[model samples]
Target: MRREAMRHRLTEEFFARHSTVVAPDLIGKLLVVGECSGRITEVEAYSGADDAASHAYRGRSSRNDVMFGPAGHIYVYFTYGMHFCANVVTDTVGVANAVLLRAIEPIDGIEQMVNRRGRSDNLTNGPGKLCQALGLDRSDNGASLLSGEIGIYDDSWPDRSAGRAIVVSPRIGITRAVDFPWRWQLAAERNERNERRRPGGSRTP
Candidate 1:
C-alpha cells in the first residue's frame, strides 16, 4: 500500500477550481517529494484581485506570475528573509488563486527532515517549517505538480488522518481577509466533532 500510494499524480481537474474549494479538500492528501512524503494537515486559500491578502491582489509581478498560471503547479515564495513558504496554484490560466500549505504530518523520510532542521518535534507545524523540512525553495516555484520534483497525491483517499475530522476557520496571520474562513485543517482529536463531515469518511485500509 505504501509504494502503490505514491504512484499517481492528482489530475489537473483536481486543482482547477476556486482555491476555497481546493484548500479544504487538500487535507489528508499525501504530498510526495522524491522519497519524502507527508499528509497535508492544514491550508489557507487566497484569491486574486478580490482578496487583499493575496500577492496578486494588486496585479501580477515577477514574483507572483506563477499564481496566474494554470492549475496543478507550485508557487513557492521566500518570506521573512529566512524562510520559504510553499503554495499550490489553483484555478485556470489568467486567474490567480492559491492555497498556502500551512502544515504537514510526516509520513516518510523522517530522518532527512530531522537532519535538515536539526530537531524533530514541531518540525512541520508551520508554512516555513514545512517548506524547510520538505526542502522547498524559490527554485521550486512554477514547477508542475503533475510532473515535477514535488506532487500531491491521494494514496489513501479517505480518512488518511485515521478518522481525524477537518476543521475550518479564518486564515492565520493575515491582516486583510482575516475573516474569510479560508483556512482548513485536519483536527487533532478523533471522532468528537466534525467527523465524516467531508465527502469520503471511510478509512483506506
Candidate 2:
C-alpha cells in the first residue's frame, strides 16, 4: 500500500473517541516529521479527567492547555530537568486528553535524530528520547500534526492479531495514582533487555 497516500491525518474528534480504542491501535504506527523527514515507532495514550494517570486529571493548566485545544495538535512538555516529552492532543475541543509518544524505533532521518538526541539507539527509545529524536521542544507545543511542520501517520499497523497481545499496564514514570492501569505496551519483541526492566521496575537510565 502507498503509505503516504493511505495516511490519515487525524483530527481532534479522533482523539476524543474512546482512548482504550485508540491507544493500542496506535501501535505499529508512524509519526512523521514533515520538515526533517523523521519517523518514530512508540506511543502511549492518556485518558481524560477520570484517568488518574493523565495530566488532565486535575483539569487544564498553562502547561496542559494545548491538550484541550483542537485535536491533531502537538503537546510538548519539559520534564526530568533536561528532556522534553511529546504527545498528540486528542479528543474534541475543551476535552483535555492526549497520547504520550513514549518511544520510537527510528525509521528515517536517523542522522538528524541522532545528532539532535546525541545518541544512536537511545534517540527514540524513551519518552524524552522520542522528543529529542524528533527535534521536538517547547516550540513544538500546540503545533498542528495535520499541517505545519510535524504530524502523525497511520501507515504501519502492528500485528495485533498475532498470538501476542498488546500489553496493557500502568503509566510509567509517575508516583501518584500508581494503581490506574491506563498504560499500554506492545511486547512483540520480548528480549532479555526488556525482561530485566519490566514495567513498574526501577527507573531506566
Candidate 3:
C-alpha cells in the first residue's frame, strides 16, 4: 500500500469537525514512527469553553498553551509529577479545545515501547503510557501530527470498518470530567494482533 504523504495528513478542520465524531473515526488508524506503528484504541473529547471538563474551559495557562495554538498539534502535559498525558489540539487557532489520546496498541517498535515503559502490558495502555511508548515528551507539545518524524498515516487496515470496531465507555480515571460521556474505547483486536506478531505477548489498558 502507498503511504499517505504529508499533505494528505489530517488538517485543522479535520480535528474541529466534532470530537465525538472524530474520536471513534480515529480507531484503527495508524500512528507511525519510522517503521513502527500503533493502532489507536481509546480517545476522549474535550470541547472548548462550553465543556467544563475541558482544560480550556477556564483559559490558557503555561501548561495548556498549546491548545490555544493551531489545531492538529500535540498538546502533552505532565500531571501528578509522575504521569504524562497527551492531547491533540483542536478547534480554531484561538479556541482552546483538544482530544486526549488515551491508549493505543503498539503496532511497531514494540521492543522500544517495552523498554520505555519497563513493562510489556503497561506500554501504551494509558494516556501517559502511550506517550512514553512513542517517545512523546514536553518538547513535542506543539508538534504537528501532519508531518515530520512523528506523523499519522492512513494504513487502511481491513478490519477498521464500522461494523467490526467496538466502542466502549470511557475509562474511569479523571475526577473533574467524570460525568461527561464523550470518552471512547476501541476494541482489543489490534493489541491481540500485535501480541501475535511479537513474542512474550502482553495486554494494556
TM-score against truth, every candidate: 0.88, 0.80, 0.81
Give the top-scoring candidate (TM-score): 1
Estimate candidate 2's alpha-carbon lDDT, on a 0 to 1 scale: 0.69
The global Cα lDDT (0 to 1) of model 3 is: 0.71
Give the per-residue lDDT of model 3 (tens digit) for 1-205.
Answer: 5344322455556776566677766766677756556877778888767777777788888878898887778888988788788887776778887788887777678998888878877677778788888888888888888778776655654435335555656435666757777877665554455221324556575
User: Which residue pairs show backbone clashes in model 2?
Assistant: 12-71, 15-91, 16-91, 41-104
Query: What RMSD does model 1 have?
Result: 6.0
Compute the lDDT of residue 20 as modeled in candidate 1: 92
Compared with the true structure, model 1 gives a TM-score of: 0.88
Candidate 1 C-alpha lDDT tens digits along 70-187: 9999999987889999999999999999999998888789899998788977778889998888899988999999986689887754345877778888887888878898989888
Best by lDDT: 1
Each prediction's RMSD to truth: 6.0, 4.5, 5.2
Off by over 4 Å in 3: 1-8, 158-163, 168-171, 190-205
Which 10-residue window of candidate 3 scores lowest in summed lDDT? 190-199
CA lDDT of every candidate: 0.86, 0.69, 0.71
